[model samples]
Target: MCLYFLDCWLRTERYYELDDGDLALFESKREAFLKKYEKEIKAYRTERLIGSGTLRDYNFSSLPENILKNLDSYPPFNGYVYQNGILCARIKIEDKYFYLPPIYDEDCR
Candidate 1:
């Protein structure tokens, strides 16, 4: 199983929020955030590497309290937050599973 954080906004909202009717135009937001968040996450990985820490070993425990609490207002949602070397979100349709962007294009396999 992926060592995932299931309830994170900066880390999960843009994708999972796509199904939330209260959020308008989430599809576009999801795409935009996917690119933006991936770059940000990659940067975090670099930061960790420079400090002698591997990306996969990093954890969210040291993040600020506010940053960790950003998802409080959104409806509760859960999924693999870190997997395949980046964040991921998935949905199922017609018995077929699909990822929001497939982080590393794992879905193409």
Candidate 2:
């Protein structure tokens, strides 16, 4: 099983507030986020790399509060953040997927 942090983009360096409607969007689509993104996010299962999967089957977690807060600073309502790596949480926007290299940050903590 995979652990995923469900998150959304923001516009002011604060946590983005999602109303019932926005929440519903996430709640309603388990396939979208878990689908795939070769552009960002690194996925691996066993010894092979996994590009996509089902969010329903994937585990969920809360993103770092600071990261969540930073997402709130973005402006575009339909864009993913992070310069060249996965942003941990947040939703996927493209129907296509991108493959990202595994993270090697010792300070991932």
Candidate 3:
């Protein structure tokens, strides 16, 4: 059972590959990405809380102080890293890791 579970886990797709230098570029623009998606992040969290019956109010302003603080610190995506021999940015949600697209500067294009 352990081996089967390990095999399934190993076979699961996790990382999204980035081009050379893309990881650094993504890191540099991380703040911008977070800011751009701030509304979406809040909506996602609100939906989660509502689904779990943890939040009775729909207004983001009404969220508990601790949850708000945690949301501020967490910022949806955790960080960028190399995993399974691939370079990618990791967005952690509910303990699951998902891919984050690179953020490019308009002038750099």
Candidate 4:
């Protein structure tokens, strides 16, 4: 199974920072992760992006405290980089689930 790193953006609290180490970690294993989860990621991302409309998706609780230390707010932000495109993870103040990106212009109805 491909391990996907979920960068969570909390709505009530800030909890993490995307730094060089994190970037390096993802970069190091990006190829392997992509090779294993390429198809799955692509398919899932397609649906999520469409479902979100114009809102961004996010995960609030998936972030570690260490990463959140740098933030000044309650909720945080997250990110996802796949073979298809870069996705930004966003969360609302009272929301639980992350809102995925909206569909591309061409994909809109």
The candidate scoring highest on lDDT is: 4
Model 3, poorest ten-residue lDDT window? Answer: 47-56
In model 1, residue pairs whose N, Cα or C atoms come closer than 3 Å (at least 3 residues apart or on different chains), thus clashing, are none
By lDDT, is 1 or 3 better? Answer: 3
- Assess every candidate by TM-score: 0.22, 0.17, 0.24, 0.20
- The runs of at least 3 residues in candidate 3 whose Cα sits more than 4 Å from the true structure, single-residue gaps closed, are 1-71, 75-86
Stretches of candidate 2 off by over 4 Å are: 1-14, 31-109
Better of 2 and 4 by TM-score: 4
**Which is superior by TM-score, 2 or 3?**
3
Tell me how candidate 4 scores on lDDT: 0.39
* Residue-level lDDT tens digits of model 3 in 28-96: 887764564343333332111211111111123333465556664333545555544433355554665
RMSD of each: 17.4, 16.3, 17.7, 15.1
For model 4, residues 1-109, the per-residue Cα lDDT tens digits are 2223344543221112234654665679887645544444543433323232123233333545654465356453334333234354554333443433333333422
Q: How do the residues 1-109 of candidate 1 rate in per-residue lDDT, one tens digit apiece?
A: 1112324443322222123432333354766544544533333222212111122232333334654466233222234455545443333333433333232222322
C-alpha local distance difference test of each model: 0.33, 0.31, 0.36, 0.39
lDDT (10s digit) by residue, model 2, range 1-109: 2334334542112122234654565578755534432212332221211212223211122334544455443222223334332322234323423222222223321
Instruction: Give candidate 1's error at residue 34 in angstroms.
Output: 22
Residue 18 lDDT, candidate 4, scale 0-100: 38
Best-performing candidate as measured by TM-score? 3
